[model samples]
Target: MCWCGIAVSQILAVRVDLWNNGNLVQDIFLGEIKVPVKVLRNDSFQAWYLLQPRENGNKSSKTDDLGSLRLNICYTEDCVLPSEYYTSLRNLLLKSSDVQPVSASAAYILSEVCRDKYDAVLPLVRLFLHHHKLVPFVAAVAELDLKDTQEANTIFRGNSLATRCVDEMMKIVGKHYLKVTLKPVIDEICESPKPCEIDPIKLREGDNVEINMENLRYYVDKVFREIVRSSISCPTLMCDVFYSLRHLAAKRFPNDPHVQYSAVSSFVFLRFFAVAVVSPHTFHLRPHHPDAQTSRTLTLISKAIQTLGSWGSLTKSKLSSFKETFMCEFFKTFQEEKFTESVKKFLDDVSSTESKEPSGVSEPVHLKEGEMYKRAQGRTRIGKKNFKKRWFCLTSREFTYHKQQDKEPIFTIPIKNILAVEKLDESSFNKKNMFQVLHGEKPLYIQANNCVEASEWIEALCRVTRCNQKRLSFYHPSAFLNGNWLCCKATTESTEGCARCTADVPADTQIEIDGDRETERIYSLFTINRSKLQKLEEACGSIAVYQGPRKEPDDYSNFTIEDSVATFHTLQQIIDIVEKLNESHEKYQKKRSSSAKYGSEENPIVGKVS
Candidate 1:
């Protein structure tokens, strides 16, 4: 298939390098063959010949197939390389060796083009960086003028590639950029007793004296907060900043937990503050995340934090005063009160008026066959804010709600109808505890006494519905965790969605799903033993052969025939016996089915399978 839709030039010739005993013995002409002209750029073709080595004079039998052959396809002589700068640069980079200077020059020229052209070249630069090919990449970056420099920084500040390359650039260009931006902030934060002098080189190399630990901690926290506030889309930049801070801490006060923690805490708080401010309702703090930017950020942050821990003890000198009070208070916000649990019990008491009802009022119908799992008095919303009391009941077969005990049910929902159950924000609709059950287009909103009750009810509902349906709605793991729509199930009309979703495996595809442990053990043993048997035959010069009725002269060797059956004295007998049994069973099945004259559709078992 020609994926590129461009015509490729003809290949001039193919040269083979022959190697013997790990040494290149000779370069041979394997008969000149011309590659087809105007070939589709991305299409592939196959060519094969009898793989035989040439015999040496008086040493023909000594020639062996153990040597290696290397094939090279020549195209520069007959083929025209793409003329566009981008394509030209790609071609330059494609050369195996001795093209770094050419590639570098091409990159510099591309950078000198219009701003958009330079932007297009940025991805290629990033590719080179990703492969750790920094020499030519840095050479190209050095060609950028002041305007190009500012534009590149602006465009890629949030980009992971730029963030990653920035740290490397610091080593080359020195920390003039950081010094210019950070000096003012540091001066502002480090007030009385005079802030320690700032040295860009020392910071870049991870060595700097710390005259004021407290001042540095406050400075780190404030500066990082500003970085998060700037909303630079690149996590690499943010992470590199943390890395620099870690180095500073390491060089200033070795093995000091407080100093090391300042770096870690700064990174954590930067993320925490970023996520908190962006969408207060959700915990998604990842900026430009679920992509390369987020991945780069996480990698850098994790490495930076781990590096910090290695520099000093994580558990040292008891909890810091700031951690003891403020940290404890911060986490307390995420906890739920114990009152939610007791609210369910209290609601049950109030709704227990069935026992005092008049004798004439017949007891409400009970689901006698259904095993009841949960029963609670909850309130279902009527409109936007109307909270009407209802008794919710969950059984093995269905979910039911009643206006009250000893009364006809308001609604009965088959468990299978429940598509999904999700807990709603407690603050939404000014309700303390609420959840919604989605069944097709209609959503039933219900309020519990507290968050705990709402969560428990949602869990119970999902558990029952899952069992009844056996197949839940398909969703990405990330979507489920982030409380977002499944990429596959998104409301968008376009077919484009998550690319990672698995496609159905074709029947012909060689995919093997492993079986149970015992089956695996047996299979492994069978494979090992079969391999040994093959090696034994090769060593003794007695190859295995098939002796069945359909066997040909070319199929078997050193075989014997018995009274009615042909038998082969080889380890392949094990495989032949199994094949014969399978063939006979299949024939017997076909014969029986034909005699009965039963169509597959009439036979549920047969039709249900294939």
Candidate 2:
């Protein structure tokens, strides 16, 4: 009989023991059968049976056939097999229709067989999804969908297949489907734009849309939980998803206070999440880029500060707390010098333009002397009988001087009538003996025979004056020698020209006269003592005299020569010296206190310095 003509029962019972080197690997059995009698008629005709190992004796259902097959044949001991046989066997095992005894084992087998040929499996999974009501089949299809998304995405870029699979899964499991579907979507969204169309109306009507505070809160909480559960190893992707969701939440429930509050709250949690996820070693990475997650975190903080600052009713305590939180976080991140440039740019972008000065406060002004005019000087009438003209002049030291120019004793002299008025330096009045010719304790007098002689005498007296005095009196020769004298006394108290003296004189009292044929004769005269003049000069230089009446006797008496000179230093220089001393003293005190407080060997001065 030919090999092809052999009956099923006539096939040989084939048994094979397989080994690697000397180790016994496996034993496999082929069905009992017989070898054909006429098989040798064909040159290539050989009766052979191949035996393959099964997992658990259930040959039809096993997934992995680990052991090699053995063959019962009439050929030589070392027969060569064609490679096509192994290829055909693999193809047969992989076909879903050929898998018998349907079980998880068979499913495992099918998964492995079709692992590389996803296109081939796609058709069968589609068939199962169409015809099967089995939950396992649905789960299997969902797994297949997840596994094939990248391929499906590439194949159907703008179509509905990708979204359809997700929608079906979600419908089957409700909210729980998120646990299965979110990760793939997160990855996809991060990698590319939303591939599937989202129904804006449906999303708006969803549980997240409820304006009630509690419902919104619940929705936000759920979304946060989902995000937290996702594997966000890729921070860039994580950040993209975060910002997308935040953008959605913000758009959908913009007017909802609770939604706004929850969105900001979620942002805060996300920041902390990034901080926790980033390793200390890699913490400094991408600080400038800061991913979308960190940007959202900073933006939310800024918004909170702005909202509180703007809200008229926000309490001071709440505002303070908000500021404190923002400042603390800002400073912590900003302390790093590497971030300074970027931080400054961000601050400039977000900072308010209006000045921070408080409302209702006036701007400060600087006053100067030229802004106002000086007051005119006025005089008081003296005694009930007469009014004296007096004016005030400002001295270089800023002191005011009251003077009656006409009352100056020198104004009444014959020289005053003879000489033209001359403007002298103001310092001329400050000379030691200038005022002594007018008034002093010891007065000088000259006796002249006539007005021409007196004019000549007055000019000589003015030239020889050497001390500042309170008054000077002029005497006529006849009046002085006969004891009937006309004396003109200079007084600062005079309201008019030096108290005028009119005295009748004896004609015969011709005091000693110097001979000058063309000029008037000279007369007897008295001079102030030389020692008294010297004393007066010393007193004038040492004392600071005021033109006003004395209020206290000791005011002038107690002043020392040195005190006046010392008082003339600039106020600023004095203050600077005092400040330097104070600073040095304070520094010393601080050093001593610090040393005592720490009492370390490095600070040995703690006890010894004090």
Candidate 3:
């Protein structure tokens, strides 16, 4: 197309030839063809050619003849349209007097408009507010606009148009949008202050505000109710909104008890609601604003404690009882640190009093009935014993000791002082078999089983038992029967030695024998000189020779006399006088029998009669 006055770049040029009924009419320059411009839904423009002959040369202009022309044109640059056109269209519709009929179109256009141009449409926003209409459409537009602006982060500082646009946007978008964008706007308002103009009535009435406030509250309440219904749903969003409201309430209605109470009560209810809905394992999302979150938490804790303090008021109602119970638990968890300290101090006090007085003290710290304390006695380690005895004063109610100190005073305090007793599991606590030391043909209890329960038995053993860690030969009693002695070498290897010659005979001269033809017998023999016996008595205070069968008699016909005889004495004179002579044997037997019966009903023996 050719234009006489327009710039060449703006004109469309095309070559064309007209034909009718297979006959060429003429070759002609299409000459400034009027192209039909299309306005795209996105507000972009495109031009298409439709040719017609000049009016001077036209035979007759007819509608049917206009269809014969076909022309091709190319754009000089990229054809993508700018976004400002849509924004302008939106602004026009927003300002138009007849916005109701085309409200959907305006919203759609605004949503499609460039985020940066939202401020440009602020004048149009005033029309919506004045009419008190298009709240939903405006809300959608605002949300879409917010998403765009936040994504692009176009600076809006000192721009009155932008500030009003965002505020209106938040009003339409409801509390969720307000919560998400509040921090940024609050920060802006705090820094600049000029852009955020508070409406006095809206702040005072809150959700009850007229027109736009009602719609805003509806959406906001919907979001909150859903949050209350399930803590798992949008917990972070709920926490943020509640936290923001807490701050906003304080700022908007400072010193107003009613508003403060309403805001804090709502937050407390929401917190408890969340706790009820969420599983114990789920971690509650805290508000992003640390200071606001801390204030909210403290407020809830205080409320819970106060509720617990007045629990007696709720006795008549089921809901009140439930509330009181929840409050008690909440208070307990909230005051955990304080409670722990108090308990520790109480235990310490009891322990100190109990340990102050020794067991033998004539003037004991006497406590009244049900009032008790722990007193620790100084440990006395007698002789060469390694362990010290421990004592404790336990009230009937006391379950277990909590203090871990090695020498803690025996707590004579009431049983209630014990918080918990840790009973070692069977897997952890080792069980030892009990054994008894027997005299000749007489059973004597030596050690009791269940050492954990029998401290006295363990103490006796600890006092008397001496452990020789050095590797020594432990001869099996059956080894002597076969006329052979089993000796463990220094390397701890078992080796057989002729019983008659082995030097490692047990000091006890009594031997237990078993046979099929007779009952089990205790054989006593004089195996040591009087000097050795005297030395043993001096070292251990007293020495005894024990001889007995360990169990009922069994078959012994298969037993062979293996010519086994352990060395009774090292010197020939002592062996001959003690082992070979009948007189020495009778004397030894009489002495043993007398000593066994001395402490019993039998007559006591005097000195050893030679």
TM-score per prediction, in order, is 0.19, 0.13, 0.13
* Whole-model Cα lDDT of every candidate shown, in order: 0.34, 0.27, 0.28
> What value does the lDDT take at residue 27 in candidate 1?
22
The model with the greater lDDT, 2 or 3, is 3
Judge candidate 1 against the unseen true structure and give its global Cα lDDT, from 0 to 1: 0.34
lDDT of 1 by residue, 1-610 (tens): 1011112223533223222223232222222222333331223433443333332244453223433332233332111112331232334332312323331232232322223333434344344433335433432332221113232112222323223334333322222223333435533432222232233322334435354223334443444434323211112222333444434444445555344334333333323333232222122122111222222223323232222222122223322323334322222322122222222222222112111111112553222221111212232222343456677776655677776765676778776676656554444355556666655533466777766666557655653443223222332321211223343455533223243211111112212322222122222233334544343333223322333244344432321121112112222443343344345545756765676555444221231100
Q: Residue-wise lDDT of candidate 3 within 1-610, one digit each (tens)?
A: 2222122223342233332323231122333344323211123334444555543566676534444433333332111122332233334344433333221232222322223435324434443433333343333333322332321112122233323443443233223222332233233322332211123322333323244323323322333333222221112212233333334444455564334223333323333322321211112122211122222233333343223222122233523454445343323323333323332232222112122221223553322121111112221211213222333223222211223433444333332222111111122112132222111211111112344433333222211111111212222222111222222222322442212211111112112221111100000112322443223222222111223232222322211111112111111222233333345435655765767666443433332111
The per-residue C-alpha lDDT of model 3 at residue 559 equals 18
Error of 3 at 394 (Å): 43
> Best candidate, lDDT-wise?
1
Better of 1 and 2 by TM-score: 1
Residue-pair clashes per candidate, as listed?
A: 2, 20, 16
Model 1: which residue pairs collide?
A: 158-233, 158-234
Candidate 2's residue-wise lDDT over 1-610, tens digit each?
1111122223432223332323121112222233344443234543334423322356574323332232333432111122332232222222323222221122222332232323223333333332222223433333333333343212112212222322332222222222232334333323342111122332333333223223223322333334333221111111222233333344554554333223322322323222222211122222112223323332333333233222121334534555445333322322233322322222221121211111112642111111111112121221222222233221111112134432322212221111111111113222111111223111222222344433333332332121112222232221111222223322332323332211101111112221221010000000112232233223433444423343453433422222322221211222333344345545765775666655444333211110
